[model samples]
Target chain A: MSGVRVILDQDKCVGSGQCVMTAPEVFDQRDEDGIAVLLTTAPDTGQTDVVREAAALCPALAITVRE
Target chain B: MTSDTVPAFPMARAAGCPFDPPPELHRLQDEAPLSRVRLWDGSTPWLVTRYAEQRSLLADPRLSADVTRPGYPFPAPGRPTGAQKLGFILMDDPEHARLRRMVTAPFAIKRVEALRPAVQKIVDDLIDDLLAGPKPVDLVEAFALPVPSLVICALLGVPYADHDLFQGHSRNLISRSVPADQRGASFRALHDYLDRLLAQKTADPGDDLLSQLVTRVQAGELERSDAAGIGVLLLVAGHETTANMIALGTLALLEHPDQLALLRDGDDPKLVAGAVEELLRYLNITHTGRRRVALDDIEIAGVTIRAGDGLILANDIGNRDPGTFTDPGTLDLTRDARRHVAFGFGVHQCLGQPLARLELQVVYSTLYRRIPTLRRAAALADIPFKHDGAVYGVYELPVTW
Candidate 1:
């Protein structure tokens, strides 16, 4: 089993909301600005794939998911 | 390809096929993913055709969106004469980020989600009026245009009474065939109108995005001119893109009876939203490629784009690239089209997408379910498409139930 930690660099976020779209459970965009706000540092195992996908797919690459 | 051999960019779509993208674009995709295409001003920009390459390049920081940059390719002819350079869409990072951040909150997914009930109510009311009205009505004017126009107006605190004034100018602004002077006049008219609206918001702030921006302006967090500029960008983009999608998407469904049946019979929100995505990918309303100037040397798909070289990210073709989407040409509503770049890709991706998506979902699901017998009043050939417009759509979609 692999353990993962997700980190978001707020400054780099372009607010495309791809991360939230990909993993809404683990991420939500701040209403103040569309930047990603991590809802859970370590999401459940079932949602890992989507979290990884969100990190990979973020156009700004602001999201980092380390396994 | 060099400037001498490169053909002119912005090729027109084939006759009788309004929904399909320019066939020449696909040919280039199959041949070379990245090759130079000459623009109107004799500048040869690398036209990226493949999906993966486009996705990667759009996110690359080296490509500059600043129109003032020396080698930047202006998609349209002449400068936006009277319009001030406003909003972050045309800017590069830091500055782009600073300006865009101010307007992002109101359009965030959660914030937009909160407006679903209102959006649904608006859609239902519009459909009710549409149903009560006479048959063989123009969908663009009657339904498609009003829904987004109303939603955006309500959001921006712009008076709905002046829709005709702004809408008229918006049409003139986006039409590619409109003469430069006329377009400039339209731009000036809208700019002045927005500036006036912002002043009103500043005086009597309402519970709207523009009003909130006024607070920011008062606090010195944002510039008054920039706020007005944001208003201009939003006023036009907020409604124009979605309005076209509604009209064109509806026409597309009517043409494809099977697809129409699928959308009509099903009330599932997920299914309807997915169908909207497929339609967006299939009929990319924004036909012109995204223009950018390379800030530094960059190599992609085996071609080296030198510093100051112009690049065109043709997302319309990219959405249909066979490598990414199986049977790219077909409009399969069942396809998982979440990856579609219809809203665009990278940092400069659409800001109003969440609201647009919610509005589209409500409209697509409600329009068909309410009027099961809805059908096209005129043949596809008889309907005039906005071929010479910045955004692709039918000028007037005549339909009857």
Candidate 2:
């Protein structure tokens, strides 16, 4: 199976870090602003589940994960 | 124990255990995850106490936070007249989300993290003042209330010099026992004051949140009334909850010397973060349950909650649910307590949480490290707990080194 691609709208991101907290491997926060940055837009198979969960739980609805 | 009558909601905590929830709340969680509880209005609402039930139900679109909705549980005695014109905290979906999103940027993790140095300076200056002042200082006045109050004032572009005006009125506004007219009067005063500030910011914008909203208003992105509504909400919510948590959390740590010792010596950021989460879970300062009304029939835990049914989600009980947390009552800093619903859940979950967390992190770490000998000046029994208030905390936490 192919990996999932994560897209983050930085402007809308409230920097809750829910995405980074949920899938550390796929997402990391910028040091200066705490906005979400895609560590890996295409997360590998094992990380796909959590990457999706992070997108779903984001309060600002800033993250989008597409196959 | 099948009886036609239900236990009253807002049950009192067990005698002498000031930190824990009412024994009856735990009992209900044990016997039935979902059960009915009578409110002050003599109406019975379903009280959901378990973590799973609370999380799901809070997230359910079938449930609404709109105070105007039929059967919406009004936790406190006051009717909160003209609540529809107030902030979105009491509104549902589109309106709530719209207003909430406008203010999210300021409290975003990065933004709050950036304020860490300013927050640290605030904490440090307050501690210096406390140390130099008379022994047995009231931590609430000296530290807890001032830090968040100043921070929120700065964030909203309000002058800290006007603390006496808003802080006093905020106390009345949130007090569960204050007369309805008094609370309403206080709310109106604060609302009018903020509305005036919003109008001023429109003419002369500063570099604060109010200025940002003013810019938005000028750009035709937001209404002046909505901006003022948000200002009122942020001013109240920003200071009060975090202030209570600071006072209560410190007292909780003081009670548990073992945890305090770790926080005092342990320089691990991860450990400090975990300790904050544990304290948030254990204290659960929002003692009154989160209120809602079911918009549609929803089945959970083998019972169906019908449409128009009032529901009170007891966050204190769920935070202490043994099913979700290990040895939930005991304050274990090492426990994975991040999942606790101390901030409530779903869309209405506290928007100021990021800033609150940052402030707590700085205060807990710095206070213990600077004054290693900090101890209670007065005995725990002598301290007055806010049992009658909407928020759970000590009125005055006297402390000395």
* Candidate achieving the largest TM-score: 1
Q: Compared with the true structure, what per-residue lDDT tens digits does model 1 show for residues B1-401? A: 45687877898788888888889998899998997788877878788888999889888999998888888887668764324574778889888998899888888778888899999999999989988999899999998999999999999999989999999998988887888789788877887888798889878889998998888898998887788878888989998999999999998888898998888897777788789889889988888878789999998878899999988889899999999999998989989887888877778888898888889898888888898899999988899998888788989999998
- List, residue by residue over B130-222, the lDDT tens digit for candidate 2: 888898889999999999999999999999999999999989888888888898888888888888998888788898999888887888978
Task: Give the residue spans of candidate 1 off by over 4 A.
Answer: B1-4, B81-83
Interface RMSD of 2: 4.6
Q: What is the C-alpha lDDT of each candidate?
A: 0.86, 0.86
Fnat per candidate, as a fraction, reads 0.64, 0.12
* Model 2, position A51: C-alpha lDDT score: 84
Q: Give stretches of model 2 more than 4 Å off.
A: A1-16, A21-39, A44-67, B1-4, B83-86
- Each candidate's DockQ: 0.70, 0.25
Per-candidate iRMSD: 1.4, 4.6
Q: Report the C-alpha lDDT of model 1 over A1-67, residue by residue, as the tens digit.
A: 7558898999888777778877899999886787889998988888899998898778787888888
Q: TM-score, each model?
A: 0.97, 0.92
Q: Is the docking of candidate 1 incorrect, acceptable, medium or high quality?
A: medium
What does DockQ come to for candidate 1?
Answer: 0.70
